[model samples]
Target: MIRIEPRQSSSALMTYGIPVLSAIISLLLASIPLTFSGAPIGASYFEMFKGVFGSKFAFSEMLTRATPLIFTGLAVALAFRARLWNIGAEGQLYLGAMAAVAVGTGVFDVPGVILIPMIMVMGCVAGATGMAVPTLLKTKFGADEVVTTLLLNFIILIFLQYMLEGPFKDPMGLGWPQSSPILDQGMLPPLMDRMRIHSGLIIALICAITAQFMLARSVWGLKLRAIGENPSAARHAGIRVNRTLMSAAIISGALAGMAGVSEVAGLKGYLTSDLSPGFGYTGIVVAMLAGLSPLGVVAAAIFIASVFVGADSMSRAMGVSSYLADLVVSTSLLCVLVGGFVARFKFVRLIQKKEVTQ
Candidate 1:
């Protein structure tokens, strides 16, 4: 018979090293398919590497793709850390995008300074509103937040599709579902001329830094952490668990909302059904892999973004399917989950000796 024993908290090395190791594993797994597909696996890998990290332009694209993930990952990480199941980031993203579209289309005459902030604020408000339903149901009716939130994702997706296909559809385009291009005033200013990279990257970095500061050095952070560890204890300590959870949900929703705004105002320049490249869902993996740390989320975002950029190049250069990249990302997330569990709780064999006489 085998016995299990609890392991000690993980070391710093284990915490950081697991993700790197998992990346190597994911890459190896990805390579197997490339070889089988009659592709030059080595050259494909080289192309991917170069596509993401070789030139300034390639690096900029990586950062551009990472901007939204950073916010979405932070959103998931913050809520999860607070023990709040906020699986509706996708819906929240949609709400934000919708709100941005409203601002962009209806208030095109506003000055840039005013328009940009107005769009972002509206997006955040919409995201909070989208989160309200699940939060209220969880708090009042004892509904499972996970189920409610997940269901809401589909609801919001359908809503977005309807709007894009009906009311928001551009009149000039021949019925292809899409919104009018966001007004120039509301569009995110370019971070570098002629690059798709925008101020959204700066916003993501700021949000990450602020989240890190909040979690590490604020009174609210202490209460959140306490509640996350033990809600009963937190209540006994006079830290209102319900209130803290609600606040966390709002923050999470707002972060996801910012991702929507970034995608619309910074990248797409309009709201569309495919606004997100599943960034909201991918955020869960990023948050888990990062151990829910803000700094770690930044690193994870970059890692995932690099893989995506590399995958595009791999497809073009070696005729490999980009879907393989998604597989690798999913596999990496699974490995990280297992690694974290092992690092946090180890199993050791326990032996028992009994006297022969007994």
Candidate 2:
């Protein structure tokens, strides 16, 4: 017989060591797929590394790819810290993009100093409003947030499609379903002369740092953590559990919304149906890989982004499917989840004496 028992206290070494071990194991497992596909596993990995960091241009593109991920990862991380399962970040992101596009396309005609901040604020508000629905359902009516949040994603996607195809469709796009290009004043300025990397990277970094500080040093963060650990206990201790959960949900949505804002204003210059290649979903993996730490999210996002970017290069060079990158990421996530489980519990084997029958 086998039994699983909870650890009296989680080991600090295992807490950090598991993630690294999981990543290495994921890589090893991924090579099996490559082997079956008849690709040179070692060379393919080398190419992937070279593609991401071999030159300044590649590194810059990696940063660009990581920027929105950082935001969404932080969004997921913050909410998860409070035990809020907010699966609606994708929806919030689209709503935010819609709001920013609304402001950029002549809804606001202020200078860059005013227009930029206005767009960001509007985006954040839109995201928060989207999150409020699920949070409200959970708090007021005892609804399951996981279901509500997931369903809301489809609703927001449909709404975004309507906006692009109807009201906000760019007439000059010659039938493309996209919003008009954002005004220069509302756009995020490029961080380098030749690279597409923009000020959004800085914004993401700042938010991560701020989140880290809040989680580590603030009384509010302490209360939120307490609520996450045990809501009944927290309520008994005079904490407003619902209110704190709501706040966490709103903040999570707002951060996700900023990801959409960054994508349109910083990279795409316009809102489109396919603005995100699943960045919102990918952010969940990033947060999990980071063990829900805000600062660790940055590194995790970069690593994940590099995998995608490098896999594209490897695909072109080796004739493998580009989707192999996604497989690698998914495999890594599974490994991390299993690792976390192992870290939290110990497996024990029990043997029964046969002498009882004798």
TM-scores of the candidates are 0.95, 0.94
lDDT of 2 by residue, 223-325 (tens): 8899888999999999999999989988999999999999998999999999988888898999999999999899889988998899889888888888888
Displacement of the residue 351 alpha carbon in candidate 2, Å: 9.9
The CA lDDT at 331 in model 1 is 88
lDDT of 2 at 44: 89
Residues 1-358 of candidate 1: C-alpha lDDT, one tens digit per residue: 5655566667888889888888778888887878878888789889999989889999999999999899889989998998888888888999999999988875567888999999999999888877777888888899999999999999999999999988788887677899988888789999998899999999999999999999999999899899889999999999988888888888899999999999999998978788887898889888987889998999999999999998998788778888877887898898888787767776766677875994
Error of 2 at 75 (Å): 0.9
User: Weakest 10 consecutive residues, lDDT, candidate 2?
Assistant: 349-358
lDDT score at residue 23, model 1, on the 0-100 scale: 74
Candidate 1's TM-score reads 0.95
lDDT of 1: 0.88
Off by over 4 Å in 1: 1-3, 347-358
